[model samples]
Target: MKTITTAVAALFALSTAVAADEVCMNASEMQSSLIDWYGERPVEGPSANNTRLWVSDATGSWTLVRTTDEGKACVAAQGRNWNASMDASDVLSEIAENTES
Candidate 1:
């Protein structure tokens, strides 16, 4: 009985963990398909880095939408993994270093 309970719990945990991974919704094969899904978001000032982040007012959910100088836009990520409150240089560096072009 104990063995069966443990097995069931393990399976449940594995399933939940697998479902938590987030995939980019606005995938780009060619450059043109990368238009902003949420439309034009506001910015702080002029000459910003073509980056628009949409943070949900209710859920604290967030999505980063960045447009390259080539006019290609894509959702970089969606999670509680960002904020304008602090510097995320280390996290950003680790991600940049690990990602493959």
Candidate 2:
């Protein structure tokens, strides 16, 4: 789990350094896409400007999304092996550490 988290964090950090291919849509459409296509549902929300975490227990897949002031939702990060028992703050701290390195 820690390895997956670190890998995800590293990927996310590298993604930020490069030009991201962000897909944006109206909040409704984004929600439907996550549910229908990925079977992910919102489990966390409104952090740092309307950010939310969606997870699919069936597949252990997860996605982080953020909504803009215009109400458009965009995918920020996505990966697998999402453990509901894990603390979000811990994952975020891992991300911060990975980014710093």
Candidate 3:
């Protein structure tokens, strides 16, 4: 979970960094589109800052979305091959440790 939180944080930063090309809209619309278009559903979060992780079981795809207090939402990041079993904290720690060096 810590790893996911770190990733969510990074994604949020990345979104702000690349705001010019970001696809943003009303939060509800983004939610509906993720489900309708990619079969993704909220699997985790609405974290301390309203970030959420959405994943598609059928497609093995995942997305990170960050919503603002005013109800705007943006796709922070997205990728394929999501595996719940692989979401171990230690694995994430190792990845982060390696990244720092």
Best by lDDT: 2
* Model 3: per-residue Cα lDDT over 1-101, one tens digit each: 67666654443333222236877899999999999999998866576657687877687676768798889998765666555544533323332344343
Cα RMSD to the true fold for all candidates = 12.6, 4.1, 6.6
Which window of 10 residues has the lowest lDDT sum in candidate 3? 10-19
Task: Please give the lDDT score at residue 60 for candidate 3.
Answer: 65
Model 1, span 1-101: residue lDDT tens: 46444433332232211123533333253222222432222322212555454443333334445566665555554454333342233333333343325
Candidate 3 runs further than 4 Å off: 1-19, 88-101
Cand. 1 TM to true fold: 0.33
Give the number of colliding residue pairs in candidate 1.
0
TM-score pick, better of 2 and 3? 2
Question: Per-residue lDDT tens digits of candidate 2, residues 1-40?
Answer: 7866665564454433211788789999999999999998
Clashing pairs in 1: none
lDDT of 3 at 23: 75
Order candidates by lDDT, high to low.
2, 3, 1
The collision pairs in model 2 are none
The Cα local distance difference test for each model comes to: 0.37, 0.69, 0.64
Better of 1 and 3 by TM-score: 3
